[model samples]
Target: MYRWLLLSYPRDYRRKRGAEILETVRDTAVTHRGTRVAANLVRHGLRARLGRPASRTVVLWATVFTLACGLFTASFGTWLTWLGSRPLDHDELAVAVNQLYPDKPVSHIDRDDPPSVFIIYGSPLSWSSASDLLLGDGGEYSLAGLGASFEQLPADSRPRVLAELLQRLRASGWDDTEAVYSNAYDCVPDDPRCDPATIPSNITVYAQRGDDILEVSINDDSTTPKMSLALTRSTPWSAYPVGVVAFVLGALSGWCLFGWASRRLEVRGPLAQGSAKFLFGFAMVMWWAPILLSTSLMLSHHLSEPHPRWHPLWEWLGQPAMSLAFLCGCLALGVAALSHRLPADQTLAHP
Candidate 1:
């Protein structure tokens, strides 16, 4: 374990000091010493990669860059995991819905075959949608799957009906948790007719069977009944480990690359350095803005609803939808890297 932890350090540094570090750890007899030493090694090794240990600014920027890169890699790994799983087919979803809610007949069934990556305008991504994805209606892109709209049940018996459905699900080999209740939607206090008490609360039940997840929602209004069932696939167990490993590797790479750029630009002329910084800052904005925006929206959504299967990490980061922005960020970063050069005086002196 000690020897493996040494890999956290840069290769050259590990080669020179790894044996000494290992020997010291071996000599220690403290309780839980391995855990403490492992944490210390990771912390110090990452810091050592940043080079200018005294510059807090470098550390801050490196951290931000690392997190963004880590999320991207994690999102990629998650998408790869999704590719390995099966999508809920139309016929299968119909059968499951019938078994789960026998008496509550569905008014309509909607089948959406989402792309392996993302859906644009309720369809697979395409060249025509490229304009919409970036400039026009990118916000419409969402993770969609099978859905069924059930005929409304009597308002008074809604709770009893939902309880029966939950019981049926458990008997059919589905694992479930307690039902979650929340306001159907935010009430408008200013409106004269908007009485909060009269509005029925939304009841949601979540269940999982193998890699599949089922969500049953009951929302009835004064004039009409509204209920729906949605089916989605769950992230595989392997994706967690894949995300963790990718995050560590991405963070390390981001720190080392940022350190290299910091050192290189330090000796350049003022204009070159300034340009590089500006471009890098723009790249960061392009990369991180969608993540921040999508994260807030997704967070609110999950909080307001009962989700047996959380959306993929990439959706929260607004990937594929913001693929254009990511590409722009990459272009800006590449330009920053390629444009930096040694000053003429240094070049002459070295030559």
Candidate 2:
């Protein structure tokens, strides 16, 4: 078991002190139970790793590598989270639209409709609310073909652009004006008489309030439901995979630094070695503390109402916390290596 634990130390450490460490472990084992022996072995390894000084070249390179990896991993993870949370595909689009117009009767329009007006709605609250409604809680709807609609728009003509947007909306199931109003009104319950479904299908209404613009469909059977906008322009969040890559690199650097430090510190001494071993034991606690805390926080959040203010910070801390834990483990190993390096004079006094 001691030999196996020694494997956790740097290669130079194992080569230099493996047999002596095992012999000491065996002697210690005779005084304690197997579990305690195992624990002590771990403690010793950590001390050796921490007391050693890292080479300048190794430290510099390791630090650079760690930073690069951490940033890349963090960025990539953030992007993945964003992408995973965003709406996608036809079904996703349908859901988004439905949240925006809950009472609106949505149906796919036949592809034969002529040119028509299109109105795009934009508002941070509206977008957030709709996204939450559609993608967050209600999983029944999705956005599918909007990508194709935007792609097919004419570069030179405003009407063509309008037509394409309208066509995309129609395809996503906004075919009736009354239905649109009814859905909108239903969703916006504060509006007393704004029953979107009750609005006449043939009404040529253009309602603009603040940043919102509502373009009503004129024909009852136009097959595309007209849209109302609270705002006009919107941009999707771009996905970045670099952050995750960075996080991984940071962890690797930490590990290497830990090993280098361990090799340098594991000398033969009594008081010095014992102190290093104790420090290594303490370091182990620090290494795992964040992981335990974060896991507990996550569990607590899942069990209760999510406190919005803390969520972002918690997520941001995740990568760093994990990297730090890994570094701590390495530090512990280094400390253990240091503890094993007892001087000949001190060894006799301590023994």
Which of the numbered candidates is closest to the native, going by highest TM-score? 1
Tens digit of per-residue lDDT, candidate 1, span 55-134: 77878888889899889988788777766767657787888878876777679886545554346666866788888877
List the candidate 2 regions with Cα displacement exceeding 4 Å.
52-87, 95-102, 105-256, 259-315, 318-351
* Top model number, lDDT: 1
- Tell me the tens digit of each residue's lDDT in model 2 across 90-144: 4444444454445545443222221111111311223444443333332212112
What lDDT is obtained when candidate 1 is compared to the true structure?
A: 0.78
Q: lDDT values of the candidates?
A: 0.78, 0.44
Residue pairs in steric clash, candidate 1? none
Off by over 4 Å in 1: 1-54, 102-105, 110-118, 136-139, 182-187, 221-226, 289-305, 318-328, 340-351
Backbone clash count, each prediction separately: 0, 77
